[model samples]
Target: MFNLSYKAQRYLILFGFLTIPVVLSLMFSYYPAFSLLYYSFTDWTGLGWEMHWVGFANYKEVFTRPEIFSVFEHNAYYFVGGLIQTAVALFFAVILTGKLKGRNVFRAMLFLPYVLHSVAIVIMFKNVYHSEYGSLNLFLQSIGLGSWQQEWLGNPHLVNVSLAFISVWKFFGLSMVIFIGALQSIPADLYEAAKIDGASGWQAFRFITVPSIRSVIEMMMILTLTGALEAFDIPYIMMLGANGTDTFVSKTVDMAFKFQQAGLASAMAVVLLLIVMFFIFIQRKLLFRGGE
Candidate 1:
């Protein structure tokens, strides 16, 4: 009877401990998310006490609209561009982890951009990339590459690329830090063994460093992909005053606030959610399998 009382008391204590967070999460997070999912299928204008059932109409509109599709394409550009940045960060991480001079100072310098306010960073880049009276153009003209200077953000063909370059600059520091941690966690004896086996540095990296950091790389890839998909702040701030650039790349904020098309904006949000889920599914299959 005493043992049973003790067991029951222990179970009660554990349940008492978890019940608060569980209730709070259900009330705050889970319920709101579920409400959003339900609202996505309805024509809820985000105001008013009434909603209309619309089935898949919102999704259909999202797919049939070229502007919306362009948003997806721009998001894809971000994904690919972030991956390139992550790769470059990993390279730098490897070098910094090696016997390099003033490595800590270099790492701190590289990471400084990430700590700055994103709006400030974008504004700084805006000045740098200005078509007239800009430093970039001035330097280009000085070097006889005058023809190479162009309105970077104004050109439709280059706007997304410009945003991507800024994103890479702001985010590469995070990837570098992650990669450095992963590199440090690797056992040095493995590298020494490969060296004793006459493996070149590249060969050692391929077989030792790459495989050892595979899990960390996968985690960073997932984070980068999600961050890119939901990118809003930098592009929003940069393209605020522009006109006729209302492609998917620039209309997200306007669709939500300026136009007050809450249902449509909710639909866009849902599409973004599905994209993240798809990537997560793919990551689970390709990267998280076999307990790695």
Candidate 2:
């Protein structure tokens, strides 16, 4: 038997534990990513192995196609809704952090939607947004506010907004939980000290609470941006990307599967990836500009 030092044995064990995950990551994540990048420059129909290098033709088409690029406008509604959701979540998190009764129950109820199946949630909302027989419209009529009812998923002016609201309602609870965790991690003494220095409630929150949870807020902002850019399920499920509710992701999926334009789809994916990365970089720079 060969003898080895304790340090060498530990190193070997560590490497053994990491080997499978590293290999799997390279195989699944990196390899597919690189392959996608390569295919973006080629004309592959995604049906067979046949592919031809087409340079930036796919990229050019993506840029030149007005209808293809215009789907990004739909993402803006979700992005704005995500911002509103974050703000609402932060507000509730702050409130729940206080000595409120039934706060735990409230938190659980708030988080319930996130744990539910995504497909079920979408289907439920589809029924809720039905033009003729939706519960929303019925409730409005019952309340003598029937005039407020409109075609939620049908009207071009309101379809995106309707879908965006669903995203906010479904995901805001998760953001609230995260914000609550961040808020709880903040030391109570900081607020006490601020109060001792005669800081007002708004001043305390603005200065101490905001700065303490700055990193979490930044994370939530990044999530909001990415989620908006990746909005697909609700719009796709409810309206099938009709009535101007199509998002960038749904368009990409259509290009890839429905149209069999694999190369063009890959290019669109790369474009979305670049756009997400650019926004994330800009977000990081702006959020951490004070070196926090």
Each prediction's TM-score versus the true structure: 0.87, 0.96
Displacement of the residue 104 alpha carbon in candidate 2, Å: 0.2
Candidate 1 lDDT by residue in tens digits, 196-284: 99999999999899889888888888888788777777877888625333335356557767776666767777777787899889887
Q: Can you list the residue pairs that collide in candidate 2? A: none
lDDT (C-alpha, whole model) for all candidates: 0.82, 0.92
The best candidate by TM-score is: 2
In Å, residue 64's CA in model 2 sits off its true spot by 0.9
Give lDDT: candidate 2, residue 202.
94
